[model samples]
Target: MMKLEGALYPWRFRVVLGLLGLMVAAICWRIIDLQVLDHAFLQGQGDARSVRHVPIPAHRGLITDRNGEPLAVSTPVTTLWANGKELQAGKDRWSALAAALGQEPKAFAARLEENAGREFMYLVRGLTPEQGQSVLDLKVPGVYSIEEFRRFYPAGEVTAHVVGFTDIDDHGREGVELAFDQWLSGVPGKREVLKDRRGRLIKDVQVTRNAKAGKALALSIDLRLQYLAHRELRNVVTEFGAKGASLVMLDVKTGEVLAMVNQPTYNPNNRRNLQPAMMRNRAMIDVFEPGSTVKPFSMSAALESGRWKPTDTVDVYPGTLQIGKYTIRDVSKNEGVLDLTGILIKSSNVGISKIAFDIGAEPIYNVMQQVGLGQDTGLGFPGERVGNLPNHRIWPKAETATLAYGYGLSVTAIQLAHAYAVLANNGRSIPMTMTRADGRVQDGVQVIPEATAKTIQGMLQQVVEAPTGVFRAKVPAYHVGGKSGTARKATVGTKGYTANAYRSLFAGFAPISNPRIAMVVVVDEPSTGAYFGGLISAPVFGKVMAGALRLMNIAPDNLTPADVQPAVAVTIPRGLAR
Candidate 1:
């Protein structure tokens, strides 16, 4: 029995030793494979479970005015995020989490449930740092805060239409914001990060994509002039009880828009009650019949024809004339003849029509086109309207006559201002821009002869200085020259016009000897008894130009106070004899 037990032990020991040797060999092979042949695969699997590719948000660019005043800017903000799965695991503590986040417990739980499959979800966005820190104090699992940026407009509603506003995703939605979005938006970056079980960022491993910060943009708007225009336009719109109003002031020499304002504007910072209508930059977008404002351009065309002189007389007998079927009449009574300058000063529609008919349509069309009618201002502004001027080749006699007197053609306020700027620049038409200039004057297209421009400029001065002229547009201590226009509003969805609804317009320049500013003001559908451009719009031009000149420290050409008339009181509704 002892001999049999010893043999059995030896056999069992051999078998156990062989099995242990095989197990050790297998373990060694696995270690070799993991450390050498399959190291990258194993490392990738481990990283998938713990490491993450996180986004590094970049800051947006700043927007400033010509004077370096901040118009649109971005500030750091905190955005709350959560790991839904981890948040769901702490359902028992949801009430505390909800209290910290200012949310109802049930709703918070439901939200977690809705995003149960999501690894990350936004809890709330745009929180103050204090609010975010309070959230962190809760120490709720899966709750986190991401650094973000929120847009802020320092000028608020004052520059809203120009600076515009951005959306929740930091994209510009209107105005210069949208126009130069690509130039203003930043490029985000990515980095490999190590996260803990609770989804907190443990360590940054390496940068995958480098972030590129956005470049700053400087605009041509002067905040000082912008405020002036905004305040004056609002006041005039309210005083005249008009439907709406728009005004644009330009640096005549550079064609840089100094100020552009539209009434009924919206505050870009607070867009809680934003309306689509309030987003329009009306000076560049809205088009209307310019009424008698086109007279200067027409007169320019006539002078260019060499058939009409500044002193040539046109007989406007009884202030009415008949074309094929349409009867052209002046707003006021006239029994005699008017020279070229008198025609503009009195705004005689019949006299201008006769001049347009004599010169033919092609010449007038050429002059208007050269002066920037029927063309874009090249401002690249969003929703800018290129006004309508029909091809002169197809003009009927009646249409031609109407076109001469500022009807049957459409123009925007900016277009009118551009035309006046051409005259102000002594017949050189510089391309308009919305960006800051380098103080170098660009060569421009010579639209009219310099001599002709000077003659017309003098005539326009008469429109301000003559007793029958636009007295309201006369600025103190400056030689102001402008034309007043009162055109009946063309009915929408129809071809006729409304007698009561009028678009009052005034287009002119200040310090006429050496023109510094050319501006245009349009008051749409004035409901008050006083609806003439001379009554409502001219006064606004005078006040704004006076303020602008003083602000710019421009030397007044007419220092003699006696040459300037007393400030006219426009509160009362004057009788519209015209």
Candidate 2:
């Protein structure tokens, strides 16, 4: 057997050894090919499969009040996503993953099928951190998440018109957000990341670019004053059952819009059923004929002319005066003559028409223009209106008479407040500002002579304290003065004014001796029938002014014993602001 084995296996052993040598030689050659000559290509393919450039999200800037309280802020959120192709392979676990995501298994499977061609697909956007973690705990194969931001308004609808809101992608959609979108938006950064076959981030390799955060913005709004003004306006609007309303308060010396509020507002957080009408910023956009509110400015124009003294008398034997085809009638049918101040106190349409005819159009138009009428406040707020102040080249007697009593032209609530501010501010035309009063604030222009402004201011005070004046406009323990206006709403795109549908407005400043704050209240189409400006709007002005003056610690100029009353305890409700 031993002799046969050697003889039979010698050639076979040589053949087997030859085959083994060939195999070893081929293995060495292959190793050399992969580790040297073709190394670059193999390494490049591996890197492509494992490395990716992932983006790092940059959040929006903070919008704060002058006191450093947040009006709007960016909140962190997570977006759940999946590599649909990888996820589709794990079909049995779709129910668990879908249940974690609060979706039906069949719908989830259908969704994965729809996106099977793509490597990535979104499951849900803007999920809470807890929710994202709960879904990830299921450990489904392609599940992942990315960080994002959402804008939240702390003051809610109270600051809705000013602060605005952003879209789901963090783009500014309205209000201040839209106005300063560029300043508020940030640049996202990118980093090289290593991921496994399941598309999970393994480790960060290197940063390509750094994220740049947005700049913080500080506004001129005093949150405290804004709260008071909103509360008062809301109460009055509800009490009068008005269709809508607006109130604007200004620091006359600084031209800062301390507070501005509008009714029928919507919460920016939940805009599911938002309507454009509810989002309207009435103070800045909506226009109404200012009615007798413009008389003071007209009087200022006449006084600047020096033709009519404050004590001059005017004829008003008949309540109605015929001017061309139009007849102007006074609400109070006074049979006797009244002085210049008496006209404003009684709000006689006849007296104002006579003066408008005498002073002509230029002076009145010049005065209106000087006090920020028919002009933008330079706040750059979205949808800010330059109300219609028709300075026609040819002024008809009818138009002039109507314009004299705030009929022919229209003005926004902000413009009316700005006009009264000029009277309170000694005829200085300060530009209204939404930003804080910094070096960026513009210098005021001299709109009217200081002497004439003082004279008109005195006359406005008389309109408040006079026996036949609007007593409701006078603030207790303070030398407050304002003029009430009851103007008829004009038919849209027509010359005819609507009867019974009126806009009750009051515009003036507190502490008539040394005016500090100028405010305006407009109640549109007040339905309770007690719709006169003196009866409805003036009371709101008085209440808000009384509170604002107290909050600002302004000393009372007039401490009359009869006008003084015990201060009611003030308790600010936390919810009203936000």
Best by TM-score: 1
Backbone clashes in model 2, listed as residue pairs = none
The positional error of residue 426 in candidate 2, measured at the CA in angstroms, is 0.2
RMSD of each: 8.9, 9.3
lDDT of 1: 0.88
Residue 11, model 2: lDDT of 71
Q: Provide the lowest-lDDT 10-residue window in model 2.
A: 1-10
TM-scores for all candidates: the values are 0.90, 0.88
Query: How high is the lDDT of residue 283 in model 2?
Result: 92
After the best TM-score superposition of candidate 1, give how far the Cα of residue 419 lies from its true spot, in angstroms.
1.2
Supply candidate 1's per-residue lDDT for 528.
Answer: 71
Q: What is the lDDT of residue 446 in candidate 2?
A: 85
lDDT for 274 (candidate 1): 87
TM-score for predicted model 1 compared with the true structure = 0.90
Report residue 563 deviation for candidate 1 (angstroms): 10
